[model samples]
Target: MTKFADIKGFVFDLDGVITDTSILHGTAWHQLADSLGVTWTKELGDGLKGISRMDSLEMILKAGHKENDYTQAQKEELAAQKNTNYVAEVDKMTPANILPGMKAFLDDLRAKGYQLSLASASKNAPRVLGKLGLTDYFPKIVDPASLKHGKPDPEIYTKGAELLNLDPAQCIGLEDAAAGVQAINGAGETSLGIGDATELGAADMVFADTSAVTLANIAKHLD
Candidate 1:
């Protein structure tokens, strides 16, 4: 574990990595698209992952060929409505909603004294964590509102390391989205992707799911 010795913290992305909120997010965006008379597609839904709410809205608008149709204030109103829809579902989350093996993995990380911080683009990260009874696991959560840039720009992960008082080199970033893995790599942290190997090939390591993200398994890849 010599190569892992310097690792002091873990920065996590909340959506697919921590739990599955894609349905909630998709439903919200789908409803908004329908209201605006825009057609929704699977490809459009996939593009929203690991991105900020505003960015997601813009993407949806572009997909509908209505990018210039809404004023800035109107766009904000639409985004807010989308959030309202997402939050209604998020409020229903419970500990049971925590992904399989994730609680055990978090417990292992904590027992080993590895600091944890969240770098989710979602503004509702705290509420989701609270609902899932996992708020205390992450002492620091980078507020998306404070960032000038989102995932794949490195700002969020860099700030997460900063909040832990650690250098990017001393942290491992866990994510399940391509943009998030890019953000981790861009931040100079060890990147671990928790999904399909082909989609996440850029990461330093890839796990099929949370069940395989054990500390021992992580040690093997750190070297």
Candidate 2:
């Protein structure tokens, strides 16, 4: 068994991991770019990975050649509006898109008595989770306001470990973003990378996506 404090507790990232909202985010950025007359593409939007909504706006605006024009509050408003648009677009996502294996894995962990928490950079994370009806799965959610720093900086992961009352070494972090993977490692927990290999490189081990993630794989790390 894993020796990490509350070896049963799990910290999961929201965007690319638990929900398929990244695509929505990409579409929103693309829409923003179009309105701003900027060139937007998947590659251009890729850098938004594991970032806050406000930061994403700043980045997108920078790409639009108006970086200095958007003030802090304006950025916040745009980010919020972008979130609104993104959510409306994603309202179509059903149980069909919450990733094929995530529910089963979470249920299995719950059966084993593990505490589950959500760590996400999105300020709109609560709404996202609420929309998906996944609010109950994570009683402990560490949102952007919960910490002074975001992913790749590790404050979120560190806060999750603290909230779970577990040693950093014993906790495990799951993320699909390169920045989040770095945050997990920075927080001193075993990082479980999902999706891209670059993100997984920061992890002690990796899964291609939620479908590839399994309780068995988690057990391997704990062992």
Candidate 3:
């Protein structure tokens, strides 16, 4: 089995993996949809996971059958408005909001001399990290604004590896979204899915949730 000892760096997805801000994002989306008189559902919220804000807005628009109704500027405005709501929710976050075992796991990785980076589609990654008191754990944050494409594109994960000065194969990527798992796999790295196995079949291994993921379990995947 591959051991955690073999992994030189760790690349993490922010929202669902490191924290539970997915609900806040979903709530913002619902508010936006409600304002537009569009019926938003939990199924649609699932689609927004690991995707960019503009893309999520586009999906909402498409779902509402109003995709072409808005100009590019209008779409940008709508995305910004939703971000305002999401940011407000984020501002209320505390370190306690971080997933169980996450802080300790990060500490363990740091003590083992592994570099860490965050590769998230959220433009507010830094803000969220700051809110959760996790900004210090990740030295390298792959900015969403720097990427031309989002999750499922491999660009973010690849960039994360680059920032950590490690090869993709030498890094372990953790995510709670299928698109993120696909992106990690596409980048030729090992993927540890942090959610339901059925939703993350592309991952090399799956954990039921962040609380279930342990350093020992990560090491087992290194093989």
TM-score winner among the candidates? 1
Any idea what lDDT model 3 has?
A: 0.87
lDDT of 3 by residue, 33-126 (tens): 9999889888888998757688899999999999999999999999999989999999999999999989889888889888999998777889
Query: Which order, best to worst by TM-score?
Result: 1, 3, 2
lDDT of each: 0.91, 0.78, 0.87
Q: How many residue pairs clash in each candidate?
A: 0, 1, 4
Question: Regarding TM-score, does 1 or 2 come out ahead?
Answer: 1
Model 3, residue 125: displacement in angstroms?
0.2
TM-score, every prediction: 0.87, 0.82, 0.86
Q: Against the correct fold, how does model 2 do in TM-score?
A: 0.82
Across residues 37-133, which tens digit of lDDT does each residue of candidate 2 receive?
A: 7788766789996566777787788777889886788777777778777877777666666777898888888887887788887667777777776
Q: Looking at model 1, report the run of 10 residues with the lowest lDDT sum.
A: 1-10
Q: Give the alpha carbon lDDT tens digit for every residue of 89-179 in model 1.
A: 9999899998889999999999989999999887789999999999999879999989998778999999999999998999999999888
User: In model 2, what are the clashing residue pairs, if there are any?
Assistant: 4-170
* Candidate 3 or 1, higher lDDT: 1
Give the lDDT of residue 76 in candidate 2.
77
The collision pairs in model 1 are none
Give residue 141's error in model 3 in angstroms. Answer: 0.6
- Compare the candidates by lDDT and give the number of the best one: 1
**Which run of 10 residues does model 2 get worst, by summed lDDT?**
1-10
Stretches of candidate 2 off by over 4 Å are: 1-6, 50-80
